[model samples]
Target: MANRIHPTAVIGDGVELGDNNDIGPYAVIVGPTVIGSDNWIGPHCVIGTPASDRGAPHPAAWHDAPVGDPEQDGFGVRIGDGNRIREFFSVHQGTKRPTTIGSNGYFLRSAHVAHDCRIGDGVTLGSNVVVGGHSEVWSLANLGLGVVVHQHSRIGPGAMVGMGAAVTREVPPFTISRGVPARVTGMNVVGLSRRGVSPEAIAELEPYVIQGAGELPELPAELAKLLTEWAREGHRGEH
Candidate 1:
């Protein structure tokens, strides 16, 4: 049940890592960070660093330990279990609250998750994807390579963003959004199919996202729960 931390990896104070974590060489993990089990943290990943927010303190830049004070660590970062964070990935600490990452995420090389973001489970952030502060990428979303999500935006569940797009607006669930300022080109039928959503359900759900209005179809329980919350918040016509 012991963690496999490389000799060169710097595990600073206040870090709480769970069992069976494979932390690669030169990966610096500072705390207040609570990383769950079965994570493969690749080399040179800098996690739990102070926020780049102009207002947050910058003690981590010069201090031997990134999070010099446990309380002044620019807020906390909590990453869930079964994640594969590739080399050169950086997740900054939150400016107001904890930057939370749910279980089973795959962050590719050089992806940057900025402060106060909430990344849901089964999300795939492709290489060099930059998610701005306070953003929420809902479960099962796929952000392609070099996609830049605007600050405070939300990428809804099962959405697919094309490579190298600048996402300035919200992306609705199960849609294929592309282009600068990203618009919904079509439904993500492929992704929906992969998720085992039936043709009947996909048909029923199409109007909800397309028109960006109305009640949700009787989707699968998991889909229903997530989208219902999204709908209840009146996220219509903002996509």
Candidate 2:
């Protein structure tokens, strides 16, 4: 299972490619980078560029780390197995630390994963999505096309961010977001069903809850407590 690097690709020193990877034409991979098995890096994608050189750091840049690392090469990107990174997507290596993407994530065309981000498994980033640095997108989260995640916010496991949404704060698990500022519309009903979440559980959660972001404060303490319990359970249940 050797890697397939396109003739036009520029693979720099310290770059490690795993088995069966496809490096598309004109893709640039600056090193100290480690890409896992079955990765599809599409055409014109830039991987592991030195910091400072990437130009003015975005405001969400600190979301990756505290910043101010003397050497840009000190930052690196670590991608797990089975990821499909589409054309024109850019995944920046970490600054002061390593940016990590878990297994089974899909990045559609033009999606951006900034420095120091920690993405969990089974995540899907739609076209033109932008994930700010140092952000944490938990497992099973689906970000819609053109969604913009602010720096340092945590996307809870199983969250669904709708297209064109601007997410400034954390999105709790099993919630669906859509709006200018991205309000939670409801639970991810379809997602839950697909995953085989029992109907009784969904029914119980739907009633004791307020559906939107603003209403989180209004949810009953008992429900809030239960949410915490459920999250703990999920953590323990992960494979």
Candidate 3:
């Protein structure tokens, strides 16, 4: 199927789009940004703008528009398939590398992903959520409304962050985090159970979430991979 792009939308140069995308009115997708299939980009959403740094250059995104220099265009954004990006969301261009968003994501209104952020598959970011630059939100993680993730932080796979929390540090996998400076309060048992994780495995992962230092109990291959990554990243200031 063909893409449905509103005439009022601005698709700048070097922007590549796959099939079946729905781009709404007044949305701006600038150059160097690559978007995959089946994406719903809502009104007023912006993607692949310049990095947030004050000194960064704004490269020309349009085709031969002669507005800005394309030679200095540092890096752009790469978005995967089946994403539902709601109104007023913004994804900034990367400073060092491409700011990447994985497949099957749902970002609510007024959310923001700063430069160099990495978002994994099946993630849901609620309204007004903001993630600082270089942060990573792993697969299946759910962030509630108005959650603010600090720079260089990681929210591990299947983690759940409650609304209005300010995450100053990393969040471990399969955990529930909330409050001002978010800390792991409990396991994400509901999420785990919904994903069909066995009770034994969920119980075993509890210590890993709580203590943040221990041998991981036997889990499914994917869960094990996520845990290993969490360990390697080292729950930086999880408390």
What is the C-alpha lDDT profile of model 3 across 1-239, one tens digit per residue? 99999999999877889999999999999867889999999999999887789887766565443233334644678999999999999999887778999999999999999999999999999999999999999998999999999999888899999999999887888889999999778999898888778888788778767675456877777777877776776662235
lDDT of candidate model 3 versus the reference = 0.87
- Give the TM-scores of the predictions, in the order they appear: 0.92, 0.78, 0.91
Give the per-residue lDDT of model 1 (tens digit) for 69-188. Answer: 436544788999999999999998887778999999999999999999999999999999999999999999999999999999999999999999888878988899998978888889
Per-residue error for 58 in candidate 3, Å, reads: 2.7
Candidate 3 lands at a TM-score of: 0.91
Q: Point out the worst 10-residue segment of candidate 2 by lDDT.
A: 210-219
Each prediction's whole-model lDDT (CA): 0.87, 0.75, 0.87
Give the number of colliding residue pairs in candidate 1. Answer: 0
Extract clashing residue pairs from model 3.
13-61
Model 1, 143: alpha-carbon shift in Å? 0.3
- The clash count for each model shown is 0, 3, 1
Error of 2 at 23 (Å): 0.8
